[model samples]
Structure formats: C-alpha cells, structure tokens
Target chain A: MRLKHLLASVAMSATVLAATGAKAVEIEYWQYVFETRVKAMDQLIQKFQAANPDIKVKQTTFPYADYQTKVAASIMAGQGPDVVQLFYGWTDNFISGKMIQPLRASAFPAADIERDFFPIVSAMKRGNDYYGLPTAVRSLALFYNKKIFKDAGLDPANPPKTLDEFVAAAEKTAKRDGGGNLTQAGVTMDMTGQDHQWWREVLIRQNGGQPYTDNDSKVAYNDEAGLKALTFYIDLQKTKKVGQVGFMDEGQAAFRGGLAAMTIDGTFRLGSFNTIKAFEWGVTELPANAKGERSNYASYFANAITTKAQGEKLAAAEKFLAYISSPEAMKVWLEVVGELPARRAAALTPENLANPIYGPFLKGLEYAHTTEFKDEMAQRQVAIDMVNRVLIGGETPKDSLAKAATAEQAILDRAAKR
Target chain B: MSATGTEAAAGGLWSRLSLSQKQVLWAWAFLAVPVLFYTVIRFWPTVQAFYLSATDWNVMRPASYVGFENYRRLWSDPLFWQVFRNTFAYLLLGTPISLLLSFVVAYYLDRVRFMHSFIRALYFLPFLTTAAAMAWVWRWFYQPVPIGVINDILATFGLPQQPFLRSTTQALPAVLAPAIWAGLGFQIIIFLAGLRAIPSTYYEAARIDGLSEGAILRKITIPLLKPTLVFLVVFSSIGFLRIFDQVYNINSNDPGGPLNSTKPLVLMIYQTAFSSYEMGYAAAQTVVLFLILLVISLVQLRIMRDR
Candidate 1:
C-alpha cells in the first residue's frame, strides 16, 4: 500500500508539471575537444542544469581538425547543435553563411556587451547587433626559459624589453655547432607558427602602421611597415642566425625540450608549460619596437546559437549562454581551464591582475586587437607564401611582399563581390 | 474463361524457353541490385561533380552556372600546376618502388621453410595497421637528433644528423618511404598467394632440362605471374595516385608543408573545398584528377595487357 501510494504521487506530479508548460527541453552544445576545456565545459553545464530544472544540456566535442567541417556540414543537414562554440577567426564565414543567429536585443543588449567584454568583442559585432560572447580571451606574450638566460650571462629577472635587446639576448643564448647547424634555437622566428603573429601584431603596429583597411576588405600590409616587419623576422633566420624554420614545431618543440631560449606564444600555452619539469620558465610582455610602443594579438572562442534553433530551444540556449558568460562561470573557467576571463569585472580584479604568470597577458589586453580578414585561410596561405619566398626561395622581401599584396588584393576583391 | 485460357497459353510458351535464355534472365535479375545501387550512389555523384565543375557553388547559395570560369581559374593558378607535378611524382615513384620491394621479399621468403607462416605474418603485419598510426610513427623517426631514432643511429656512427622531413628535397621521399612500407605487406601477401598457386612441375621440369635457376625464373616463373603482376600494378598505381592520408598525417602541422613539396592532388582538393569552401573550384580540380587517373590506368593496362 505504501509503494503504490508513492508511485501514484510521482506520476501525478509529472503529469501536473507537463500540464503547466514545464516540460523538459534538451539543448545540444558543441565545441572542440581539449583536455582542460572539456572538463571546464562539463562543470559549467552541471551548474547550468542546476539552475534550470526543466532544461537539459547535452555537450559534444569534435577534434580540432574536424570541428569546423563537422559544424558546417551538420548545419547544412538541418541537424546542427543548438549552441556551438566558434573561433573568432571563423566568425565571418558563419555569419555570412547564415549558419548562426544573432542575439536578440532585449536578451543581450549592445551596450551591456560593450561595457562588460574586452574591446576585441567589436570583431564579433556587425552593424548594431552582436553575434557572440567569449568566456575567455587570449593574448600573446614572451615565454622565456630562465635557465637559458642565466647560462648566457643575462639577468634572469629582467627579460628583454625592446626588439633590439631581444635580438642581442637571442644572439648570446643561441647555440650552434662547428658546422653551423642550429642545435639550440634562441627564439622561434619561423613563419610556420608564431612569426606571423609577431610580425603583424607587435612589429607592424609598433612600426606605426595599420595591418588592414576598408572594414578588413582590403590588403594593405604591402607598405613600408610590412617591409620592415618582414625584414626584421627574416633577419632572425638569415643574418642574425638565431633560429631556422625547418624544425619540428617551428622551435616550439625545441623550447619545450630546453633546446630553445624563448618563443612568443599565446596564454593557452601556459597549461602545457605547467607540465614541464625540466626547465624553469617565466612569461613577460612581448618586446616593443624602437619607439617603446607595444602591441599584441588577441583571439577567442565564443558560444553561438545556430539558425536551426527556435522558440523553446532558442530560449534554453540563451539561458545557457547567459549562465556560461556570468562572472561565476568565468571564474570557474579561469581556475579550472587557465583561460583568462573576458568579463571586465572578473578579469580586472586585483587578485587576477596580480598573478605573475597571467598578469603579462592581461596587460596585453589594453592594446591588443583581433586580426580581421574576409578569408582567413586564404590570407594565411598568402602570408606563408610571402615568408617562404624570402626564407627558402631566396627572393627579396620587396618583391615577395609586392606579389603577395597583389594576390591578397585579388582575393579581397573577389570576397567583396561575393 | 477466355482470359484465363490466354494467360495459361502464354505461361506454357515461357516454360518452353531454352536453358541459356533462362540463365540470361536469372543473371540480369541478380545484377539489377548492384546496377541500381551504383547508379544512385556512385554514378550520380560523378555526374553531379562534372556539372558542378562548370558552376560556382560554395554550399551557401543556390549553385549558379558560370560556364568555364572555374576551369579557367584552375588553368591560371600556379599552385595547381605544382600540385599536378607532385601528384604525378607520387604515382611514378611510389608504384614501382613498392612493387619491386614486395616482389623481392615474396621471392626470397617463398623458399624459406623455417617458420614460414610466422615470417609471412610478420611481413603482413603492417598491412593490418592503420595508415594514420603508421604515418605518426614514421614522423617520429624523421625527427631531429636526440629524438628521432634514425638520427640517433646516425649519431652513434659518428655521422652528422640529416634533416629528413624538414628539407624540401628530402620531404617527398621521406613521406613516400612510409607509404611504400605500409603497402608492401599487402602486395607481398598477394605475391605469395600467386606464387603458391603456380604448380611446382614447371620448375622441376626446368631443372631436369639443366636450366639455371635464373633461366627458370625468367622463362617460366615470370611468364606465369604476369596476370598477378598486372593486377598488382594497376591496384598499386591507383593507390599511389590517390595518396592523401600518409602525406596529410605525416605533415599534420602543415597539411602540405615546406612550401607544399609533398602535397598530393587529393589534399589540395580537400583544402580548396573544405578550408576555403570553393566547391565548384574543387570539383573542377577533382575532374582533372579523375582524368589523370583514368588515362594513367588505361595506358598502363594497354601496355601491360596480354601482348
């Protein structure tokens, strides 16, 4: 009699909940698979579910290589995830393709976003509407091995503050054998990875030049500033002989193996650096140009709602996004995933601003900007071609940059028409 | 009664048909499933790809007809020409090298009676392994000194470390080495089966006639293995022509790295379609690849066929 009464009460409550328009709704969220990121997302989902009793969040992750393709294909098939996390680099395609819907004004106001998030959020906005909000924003900083500095008779506490000093320090720390093969690289200057970031953001900007124009619909990096930047990077390999581009990971593997002294990489690398026990390393602001002006590149991945979502599903997705972007969730991401928060109230706190490992990256947020382009992959190919022409093809920087500019301009023109 | 009588007369005439006609009808019925399947799945997409080649489709908008514009772009693009050379290089170098190495291994191992099955299984092991896994292991072997096993061996011999996958001139061969190694196992297995199928009487007869071992191999063994040889050559040629996974995996950091010295045609198609979302352009490139593969295979078959 007691068991029968208990079953009857549970069934009655379920029926009443359904009748009152409180039926359970499930929303799927997708992201790229990363160790720390997966754990952090799981924690955030648990917190979100606790707040919304009638909503369920199903999280899926794809490998980094296949994430974009999977999302685009799924959307084309009309079965995409309700909410998806996309890199800011991919924002243009998703928006123009009409794969994602913009946030409703009443739910997420433009003023609130501008005041809360970093300035780089402007890249995610079109006209008067914003597309997405990041939980964390990343910036590049100088990661130097402390022991390499000490061995080279340089001060361990004080890293290079200017490009000239940085080169001098690299010369002292770089080690080559009798035959001049690079056994230990000083810094990674390969265009294969960080060299492009260092050139465009730090060198070009510090040289007092803009990297693009016309709402990022034009390629304007073929001027004097670009020439100087390319010359500076090429000198590291050809003239200064501090590094070469033929290594496994563009000297990243060498740096991690204690064979390289320094590399300019994003804060996402801090998690990987923490696992290294062979060397003592520290992070500092990227070295400035001769004028003492500094700049950095900022990138982020943000949650976006898909066009397939509607009505109840859209409401659930919006609520989930709001919870994930909250200060509480940002703090959890920072603590668990080591990605610095994008929210001003969370990131600008005294405790966060004082941390030695993360402080330099946070400082970079003041002057950093996202590199916007119409077709990022095509432009990246152009950069690679430009650098390879100078480094391996033995072509002059003047000639290569001119040709690359023409090619990039053609792509931009085509993109504009499309 | 009149309709029933007419149907019975037609049924009686059908039952009186010849045995060969019944067999032909039965064969057609059996083949219908696969024919319909291929028309729907394979042939339809191939026809679509040809039509899409002339249009401009980015998977976002409705495909618009653009005439021969995509083909014109492909003709003018320098990367397409370079990739064309790289693709042919793989087919020309990879097929013969893999075939020769497998033939040598199978020839020698056939005569060995000591743990023959075990040796054969060892030779066939790599065939069962995944291409991606094999490529990664080979990538580790091609790394710099103190990490790469090959460079480590060179160091032990007091020789200088050589950059394998990093150098442009050496990268294609370095990538090809693993591809050839992976396919060798399957080819060797097929060769062994072919060798086993040959009766020993021919060899014994050649020996009794006082012919040398070399003469017997050239005169009898080679002639008997022509069919297997032709099959393997064609199969291996197609595999080499479509080489993508090995290059893509070994050079995952940059899909076609060191200035794309090792990029095959398929990898370029993938990048053009997926990375840049130029579906029509990629389709044009795909049609070109199809033509090349078809021509190469037909030419090889014509040359290596019965004559």
Candidate 2:
C-alpha cells in the first residue's frame, strides 16, 4: 500500500509534465545509420519523446557515405542542427577554444564523464572547456570460418596468432578450380575510402613500429615499418599465392556464398554475416604482428554543439546531451544500435560485457590504435589513395607516402586557415 | 447621363485588355509556378556556388572572404593540370569515335525504311538507363580476369585476356567504351532525324550522274549531315569534359588510379571539395575549370555559327 502511494505520486508528476503544452521545444540532431539500426533509432527517438514531455527531438539521418560532407555544409550555412554527430577527431577543427560550449558542469559531473569515456583515452589536451561528447565506440576485427580451420587440420578454436601464421593459414586454405584460375581467395587487402581495411594501418603499428609517431604529425609509418608491413601485404598475392590478384571486396559475393573460409571487416558487419545462413562462422582477433601484439583500428562517433547553437538553444542542447550521454541513453545506443557502448559504466554491465557474441569487441578495444593523421578527413582520402597508388601504381611505398604527405599537408594547411 | 457615360469611357484602359492578351497572360500565370520552381532549384544553387567559391571555407567553420586567392592557387596546381589533360584526352578520342559510329549506324538504319523505327528504339534503350546502374554492369564486364565474360569469350578463341580497366594502358579506353555505348544511341537518333529530313532528290541526282554507292554517300549525305556532325561534336565535347559519374562508378577503388589514368578535371574538383573538405582549393579548381570549359564552348559556338 505504501509503494502504491509512492507510484501514484510519481505518475501524477509525469502527468503534470505532460499537460504543460503541445508543441514542446523541438531540437534537431543529425546522425549516420542504416538497415536495422535505423529502425532501432526510430524506436529510441519515440521513447525519448515520451520520457521528456516538454522536449521534442527531430532526427535526421544519412548514410555514412555522405554524412560528413553533409554535416559540414549544413554547419557552414548557419542552419545546422542544434546537436550534431561527428567522428572523434573532427572536434578539434570546431573547438578552437571558441564556439560550442563545454558540457554543463552543473548538470553532469565532468570528471566522471571524462574518466568513464573511451574517447578520453586518446585525447591529447585536457581542458575544462569541452567541445565534443561521444556516445559509442567500436573497433575492427578479423572473421574466420571454423569449418575450414578444422578441414585444414588446424585447431578451429585457435586461429592464426602472428602475421606469418596468417600467411601460412591463408596459403593452406586457398584453392584454384579445375581451370588454372582462382575460384577461392584467402584474403582481400583492397583499400579505399569505402569498405577499406583498417587492419593494414593497425598491423604496421603492431609489427614493432607505429603508423604515426611524433604526436601524429609525421609520416613515420611510411618508412621501414611501412615497407615491411606493405611488402607482407603485397607478397601475399605476388609471391605467397595466398591472396588473389585484383580480387577486391565487390568480387567477394562468392565468399559470402561460402567460397572462402575467412574475411576481415568491422564489427558493424557482424549483423550482416548473421544473415549468411549457408556457413557456420565465428569471430576472432585479427592476426598479431611479428612482435606478438594483436592490435586493431578504432574510430568514434562524437556529438558536438555547433557554433550556430548558442544561448538558450545551447542550454537546451546541453540538457538533451546530458540525457543522451547518460548511462541509460548509451545502453539504448549499444543494444539497439548494435554499437559497443562508449561509457565505462554502460560497458561494465554484465549483459554487454558477457554476451558471448560481442565479448571479442570488448576485448579488442583494449588493443585498438588510431590512424596517424590528425586531420581525419584529409588523410583519410589522400592516405588511402596513396595505398591504392602503391598497390596499382607499382610506385614504391616510400615515394607514394611522401607524395601523399605533400597533398595531406596542403589540405591540413588549407583547413587550418578557417 | 452624359457625365456618367464619359466617366465609364475614361476608365476604358482597364477593360481594354483583349481576350488574346488575357489568354497569353493566363498561360504565363500557369508557367509562373514551374518557372519559380526551376529558378529556385537550379539557378539559385548556381548563384550560391559562385558566392561560396569566393570564401575560405571548409563547409564547417565560419566562411571568410578570400578574394581571388583560390583562383590564384589553382593556376599553379600541377594535379589540376593533370586532370585537365586527362579530360581533354578523353574528349579528343571519345568524341570523333562517337560521331563516326553514330553516322554509320544512322546510314544503315535509314536504308531499311520498314525496320527503321523499331531498330532506332532498340538501340536507344541503353541511353534511357541511369549511369550508376550501367557503370556497375560494365565494371564487371571490364574485369581483367580470364573468368570475366568478355575475357572468357576471348579466351575460348585462343585470344589473350585483356586488362580492360585494371591496367594503366587500358583503363581510360575501358571507361570510354560505356560512354560510347550510352552516347552513340543519342547521336544516332539525332543523325537519323537529320537524315530523314534530308531530301532524297540529291541521292537520285547522284545516281543519274553515274555515281557509285560510296560516291553518293560522299557527295550527298556527307555534305547534308555536316551541320549535324559539327553540332554533335561540340555538344559531346561539353558533355565529355564534365565526365564524372561513369568514371567514378566504373572503378570505385580509384577513378584515376593505376597512376592517375582516368581522373577527369570535374571529378577531381568534386573530390577536392566534398571528399577532401578543401572548399577553397576546390573553388580555385572550379574557376579555372570554368574558364577552360568556357573557352572551348565559345570557340565551338563561333565556328558553328560561321558554318
């Protein structure tokens, strides 16, 4: 009876909040999502509307292919959303110590938020003035076929541990059909802005070297470490006969049709592979470097209040952020969006940490590395193009990277002026 | 009564608008919506692009006035020059080939009056499809592997499998094949229309004068189709200079990859602007590209008018 009385009082307050008015203060947020995740976002937004009766959120979404440019253009036009989503590294450009307010010190504990977020791990400059807030994080991983491993007489439970082991394993699994042409490929190392493998970047760092050194301003990875790493990648096809020449990702529909026994991709693709009913599959760590370290590449999805969003709109934006970045909102983000949670508290919950399907992701995050380029958008294009040049241009890796650095520096200098 | 009639007569100009004039006004009234729609959707963006190109902007931060510095920088960019060279190379090779192929098809189609309409529509089908969809269908077709269909058929006859798009030597030609495929049909249709409009008297006169089949074509048809040929060449040049969607989709790995073999000037500008987020540099590229395109278009127009 006493519990019923307390529930009744709470319900009355909720009702009073609801009766405040129609046309509540509406805020817009732009994010990137697709497929089942988009549906999950719709449901999550609906729930938020119900919880906060006086605040409404109008959501806009675009595919990852065009979201960055779209957001950048919108912000410049002075008509961007009240709250916007970005990649982790993009915050530096907008923050510049002006524009975008810090996380509300009164509404949320800044110390706790910083200590609990994975993005803070890689942040260089700590400050009382924060411009970026992240909601979820993830890293790339290698996927292999259990049936193929058992057929090769290797332990299905233990995949390749080192880069050499991976090469040997791949060579063993690859096969050509009756005609003297490739029918099954062991791996694909194609790099582009789209569906490009981040494994290559991480492997260089793990192979007793780093992709970026000197606070990420130098192209340190393009030297001996880069040559060793790339030679290993190229020789997989050119000499080792493990990877097929010109066998890009688009040609891998056959792989999903159960042609190859292994593939490397991001955690986001696990849901898609779940639909491949033909083959029994399992997840594992990416192959380790010669130094016996297995590291993968990671990037984050962050939200920053735009320069256009200030005053009451900025205050409202912070309140919405406080709600969205709370442990509760992040849970909805991870479970519903298929993203690994960014907050430590949200991630520590046993349901996320112990879920056998995603436990590898939690473990993989510990060894993840970021790319060496500071200006994320610039190097992302020029650097990837340099890799393609090395692969197809037949230019030595060192020359290609030096050329890319020239182009990347030009882009960085241009971006810095604004 | 006299004063009242005079007052009514004095207001005559208001009612003097005739039915024909009113009907024309009503037609313009109906067109106002479409005109407004086109102005806002098309012309507004062009104006906006021009204004935005004058600023040092990343499309993220506050835009600042940068005068003509963007244009100054583009003048010195070597990569921009390379892209321009690629675009011109594609145009020089791709345009004449389009004209000759369409002329041959148009002449043959015109010979068979019974099947002319049916064959024309049949060949025109590819032009109606979107470039993106066509590019993918062709990307697989251009695969260098012997397993690819084109190579498979070639291999069956003991011919070597050509690297249709994967090779630095072959990538540009491979990309141009689809443009030729998509473009030939339109030129063929236009040439066919021009052929139909040509009077048959000239062909009959050549035959009476003892001209051979080849002679009649050389003397009568070539002279008559000269105008259409020039127009087709100039129009196709403008279209090919802006080559992007086909090159972009043909090989997403690198449009100008295999050592910058296929990058068109316009596509590079697009990459610099949206893909790289260097709006100032992209604008400089645009202004320079605009001048090149403008010069080509003006020269073509001047020659066409003189002809």
lDDT of 2 by residue, A1-418 (tens): 6678889999999988767634577778888877655665567667777887767777888898888777766766667688877676666655642334455667656676668876434542336655566666777766777777777786777887777788888888877644445556666545542233352456566656666545555555656766667666667766776655455324344346565666676667667777877667777777776667777776676677767776666776777776677677777777776777777767766776677557667667766765534466446667556766666678877787678657766655555555
Supply DockQ values for each candidate: 0.23, 0.24
**For model 2, what is the alpha-carbon lDDT of residue B77?**
77
Which pairs clash (backbone N, Cα, C closer than 3 Å) in model 1? none
Q: Given candidate 1, what's the lDDT at residue A202?
A: 75
Candidate 1: C-alpha lDDT:
0.86
* lDDT of all predictions: 0.86, 0.71
Please identify model 1 stretches exceeding 4 Å from their true place.
A1-28, A49-60, A76-78, A248-250, A309-319, B1-41, B114-118, B149-161, B208-214
Task: Write model 2 residue lDDT over B28-62, tens digit each, in one string.
Answer: 97999999999999888767677767887776566
Give the clashing residue pairs of candidate 2, or none: none
CAPRI rating of model 1: acceptable
Q: What's each prediction's TM-score?
A: 0.88, 0.86
Each model's fnat? 0.21, 0.22
